[model samples]
Target: MTSLVVVGSGIAGLTTALRAASLGAEVTVVAKAALEDTATAWAQGGIAAVTFPDDSVEDHVRDTLAASAGLGDAAAAGIVAAGGAEVIAELISHGVVFDTDSSGRFVRGLEAAHSYPRVIHAGGDATGLEIQRALSAAARAHDGIVVREHEMAADVVLDGGRARGIRLLRGGVLHADAVVLATGGAGALFAHTTNPSVATGDGLAMALRAGAAVADLEFVQFHPTVLHAPGAFLVSEAVRGEGALLVDETGHRFVLDVHPDGELAPRDVVARAIADAMAEGRQVFLDATSLRGGTAENAAFLASRFPTIDRAVRAAGIDWSAQRVPVTPAAHYLMGGVVTDLDGRTSIPGLFAAGETARTGLHGANRLASNSLLEGAVFGSRVGAAATSAPRSRGRVGPDAAGPGPLPRQAPPRADLPFSRRALQRLLWDHAGLRRDAIGLTRAAATVASWRASRPAQVADAAAAEDDNLLLVAEHLLAAAHARRGSVGAHVRSDDPFTSGKTAPLPEATLIGAPC
Candidate 1:
């Protein structure tokens, strides 16, 4: 019997494991932390899909391409748009319940760049939690799937240009027919991000060392309205979708002057606008005071529709119904990763990637809001099916496998880290954050490279290994940012004047870390 190993427990990894197991393949899911610790469960804005009569797949595709700003792959976006309803049906069949109106209709919410109200939510802002709850329970109940938590996948074992399995950080290996990487994104590299602590780009570093081609590494998206407070809790874009306005200090609506859509403009536009304002020492606020309509009815509706956000803001001593909440741009998502096809096959055979770890081109220069969860469910199922079908991959026992080949070189002896995780994060946020310039990026790259050159030859412990991986990812991001001199979409270069709609020719997706 064929076996598959999946490294993650997010929507993508869980979905892939469950689907592959149902397709008669024994599956093993290894998560670096608890299953619930994934970014998926922490997602606030709901999944985007076309579930109504007024919304068409073309509409969804058009919106995605618009947000992508000529960098999106039409074919890949088409596949995701066409698969949304089917995946929604699949999620429902698996006991995932979405929020609905009193008339028993799926509650659709509006978000930035979306033409229609097609975003579906559950438990209001707790949509991700609800989906994760249902999927986690289902995976545990499935007999063909085995889940191992608290196990980190250190690297992908490659033999003769094909995937053999994964090597764990603690020193065990799981040889399998195929390996799937759903290890999320590198948001934790930034100092102020809404992502959890585990998102250190582990999968991307592992794939690069294993000879996978990664693309568009510089197109990191910054959330336009992360609450500017202690926890930096994300104020969902859905709040802006529901009549919130972006205002600077002294109640000046600055975004409307930047774009016609104002607060509803694409995320990249809104993020830069906020960043520029913050750079001027001006505070930005998301004011939804107008939504209350000065009555109990509006207040109850706001509380019911966004219970999680309402509770959070209330705890922070601010009520959205009557006050404006301070916010700032923070590192949020990566629109690039290990390059993959529509079915999630990477450059190397027997190796696949899903979720935030895979760059399937659906999100080109920027990602459409809420489309990530949709991608996770749709492409996860596709990859699971493709991995188990027809011809089973076998290991090649030749001189090629014996040679060092493209596998990661041995590290120098473990030495003390020159910078703490917090300090590294500040370096990333200051240099490679929302806005980039040639000078800052070059300086940051040199500093990181020097640190890498000074490290011990061999990895001393898991913490050292993690730091090494983060540095590798940061190097890739800085190099890509430096290469793309002109700004486009989420990659806003302060030195370049290129802006959206009037952009220069969209450059080819930056592919890196390929075997020579």
Candidate 2:
């Protein structure tokens, strides 16, 4: 029987374990915290898929490519887009109950850059929580899968140039025929992120150390609407789909001046617009007060459709139904990581990755809103089945095999300031955050390198290990951002001379409201 080690227990990790177990493989899932603590659970926008009759796979693929800024792999986009229906059905089989209207039709929503209303949610804005609950329950019920919680995966155990298992931070090793990394993204690398505390780029750092090739580390997606209050609560784009608008302190809809889609523009465009506004000493706000004509019916509708967000907003002492909520852009997702093929095979044999940990090229430069959940479902199953049948020996097959050459290695310089996770986050936020230029990236790279030089050889605890991983990933991210001189997708080089005249005018259109 095949033995597999699945790291991280979000939708991707759990889905992988369940699929592998059904295929007669014994699986062990390792999680940094409790099984429920994951970026997936924090997701509010629901998964993207072609469910309605008006939506087609071709249209979905086209929207994905357009949002990617022509850098996305068409084949990859087609694969995920075509697989959406099947995966959505599979999620239903796993007991995920999506929201439906009074007539029992799925409640579909429209997000920025999507041509159709295909995003489906459950529990209103608690979509991720529902998915996580159902999948976690399913995994717990499976006899062939073992759950190991409160355990951090420190490294990938490699042997003979192939992945053998995982090294746990608390101690001991779990050996397996194949190892799958579904450990989420590096959102914690930034000071303000919607990801939970455990998203420290541990999987990416482990892959890098294991000699795997990673790509597109420069394209980090910053969400345009995180509540500017404490905790950085994410205000889902679905709210905008429901007719909310973004406005400056002077009551101007500034995003409309940047793009004709206004609040419905691509995430990177809206995020950078918000950043530019803040840079000019203007605060941004999401004005949902006029949603549904701002009547009592509107308040009830908002509370019903976005319970999670409503509660969070009310807890912050703001009635979003009546007032504009202060918002800012924050690191939301990473579109790059250990590069993998459609089957989830990384450069290293016996090493596979899925979900946010793998750069499957489905999301090119910028990720279409709500595609993250679909990627987890579609590719997580693929990785599970692939890992179950992976051969003991195989040639390099990832980015290193077919793409550009490997990234240049840089030696760490002498230490300067004392290293702290907060300081690292702030540095990345300032230099590598929403908008970056050559000088800021160069300075950020040197500072990160200096901190890497002072890292302890032995990680004392989980926190220390996270700090080390953050530093390593930060260095790589800075390097990638510095190397890419042009602005594209989520990676904006403010000083790029070639960026002028790149953007054409978008056709004006009315903001889309949620499907009735």
Candidate 3:
């Protein structure tokens, strides 16, 4: 029997392990923390899929491409869109109970950049939690899979130019015929992020160190509505879909001036708008006060429709129904990583990646809202099957065929800066966050390079290892952002004069929401 090592225990990792196990492969899942402590569990927005009769795979693919700024691979988007419903059904089989209305139809919600109300949730805003619970339970029940928690994957063990296994930071190695990387995104690279603490770009760093080609590291997606309070709690895009509005302190709906879609514009547009407002000394707020006509019924509806968000908002001493909630944009997802084909084969043989860790080109420049969950489920299954079936001696596949060739890495100028994880986060947030320009990116590159020069020769523990990985990934991200001179998708170069015009309008069908 083939042995597989799947790193990270989020939806992607767990799904890969379960699928590979079912295919008669002995699988072991390595998680940096407990299974529940993943970014998947923190996801409030539901999965996107074509479940309703009004929705079609073609429409879904079109919306995905549009959001990607025409840089996404249409074939990859079509594949994921076509596979969405089936993967959603598989989630149901794994015990993920999605929310339904009184008539037992799925309670579909709309989000920005989606042409239909196709996002399905469970436990209101607790969709990710429910899916994580179900997948964790399913993986535990399967005898063919083994779970190893607190085993941070520090590096990919490569032999003869192929992936052989993983090196655990805590000690020891887990050898396998195929190694699948599903280790979430690099949100923690920024100071404010919705990702769990373990999202230090571990998988990407491991791949880079192993000499794998990565792409699109510049297109980091900043979620537009993280609660500006202490914990950076994410306010789901569904709230806006349900008629919430984003407003400035002066009670102006500024996003409408930026784009006709108003709050429903692509995430990068909305996030940059919010960042611009914040830059101008104006605070932004998500005004759900008019949602559902702001009646007593509205409060109950919000509580019922978004129980998790309601609780968090109330805990922050804010009654969202009565007042606007303070909000800011924060790093939420990475659209690019170790480049992989549709089957999850990276440039290196025996090294596969899925979910947020892999740049599958399904999400071009910007990911359509709520597509992250679907991408994880669909591609995780594909990677699992491919890992089990692909020949061990297959040759390297090179960079992703759908996207442009990998950005050239330029050597950085010499600079000196103090280095700590906190300092690194602040550096990225200030220089590489939301809106960036050439000067800021160059400065960031220099700082990252200086830190890399001074990094410890050996990682002594998990924290140190994570810091090292963050530095390495930050270096690459800065380089990519610096190289890409034009503004596109989530990567906004403020100094790029070519894209300084008014925001482009989205399709008419996707702009079908209003604030009450």
Per-model TM-score, in order, reads 0.93, 0.93, 0.92
User: Which number leads on lDDT?
Assistant: 2
List where candidate 2 sits over 4 angstroms from the true fold: 392-412, 500-516
Residues 404-458 of candidate 2: C-alpha lDDT, one tens digit per residue? 1122334655657678899999999999998888788777877787777666677
Q: Which ranking of candidates, highest TM-score first?
A: 2, 1, 3
Tens-digit lDDT track of model 3 for 1-516: 788999999999999999999999999999888977899999998999998888999999999999998889988999899998899899999999999989999999999999888999999999999999999999989999999987888778776677878777776777788899999999989999998898999998888877788888888999999999999999999999998999998999999999999999999999999999998999899999877764687789889999999999999999888989999999999999999999999999989999999999888779999999999999999999999885553433232211121222334445666788888999999999988887887677677767666666767889988887788788778767766777888888778845522233322322211100
Q: Can you tell me which runs of candidate 1 are displaced by over 4 Å?
A: 295-298, 390-417, 499-516
Estimate the lDDT of model 1. 0.85
Worst 10 residues of 3 by lDDT: 507-516
| Cα RMSDs, all models | 3.8, 7.7, 7.7
